[model samples]
Target: MLLIAVAMTAILLLAAGVVAYVAFPHRGQRMPVVPWLGHAMGKAVNAMPTGTAPQDFYEPQETSAR
Candidate 1:
């Protein structure tokens, strides 16, 4: 019984880790405001600061209000 309980606990922890990795790909550095919304948010948030795409698309003044 104890063995089965430990195995189940380990399985649950592993599952949680996998889910976390999938949800936040960048070592959990960024967290989305909405659950499972990382895919949408990451496009802008995950871009490199030195990259052209983010600079071209990001609005500096609009975001400053927040």
Candidate 2:
């Protein structure tokens, strides 16, 4: 029972780490704790498809009212 608990905890921690890596934006630089893993994570995030391109409908006009 104890061994199973330990294994479960380890797995949970790993899953959390992976989620954190993917969710946060770490452009260009690697994670301080794990450089190689950070690099891999960055690549994985880039590989995923971004469904739509952003559109800018109109340019802002200068107004006297602040």
Candidate 3:
């Protein structure tokens, strides 16, 4: 029936998508610039109103002397 054909097509498409997603080469944990990105984000955050203040953001435990 047409309904069965439509269901089979949907299932096939879903399986193919899953396979493609799993087989693709990705950047997870393998990026060389990850550390630099972290440092940049940290600096950006610590720098101002555009991000977050390093001191007040993590306060209560408070380190003395700026």
Against the true structure, what is each candidate's TM-score?
0.41, 0.46, 0.38
The candidate with the higher lDDT, 1 or 3, is: 1
Best by TM-score: 2
Candidate 3 structure quality by residue, lDDT tens digits, 1-66: 999999999999989745543343122332243455444544554675765468666557757997
Candidate 2 lDDT over residue span 1-66, tens digit each: 999999999999999876667555354555667778777777787898977754653767679986
Query: Candidate 1: lDDT over CA atoms?
Result: 0.64
Model 1 residue 60 distance off true place after TM-score fit, in angstroms: 45
Q: Report the lDDT of model 2 for residue 64.
A: 100
Best by lDDT: 2
* True lDDT of residue 64, candidate 3: 92
* Residue ranges of candidate 1 with Cα displaced over 4 Å: 26-66
Put down candidate 1 lDDT per residue, 1-66, tens digits, no spaces: 999999999999989756765767545555555545555545655574754566656565555564
Alpha-carbon shift of residue 64 in model 1 (angstroms): 62
TM-score of 2: 0.46
- Full candidate order by lDDT, most accurate first: 2, 1, 3
Worst 10 residues of 2 by lDDT: 22-31
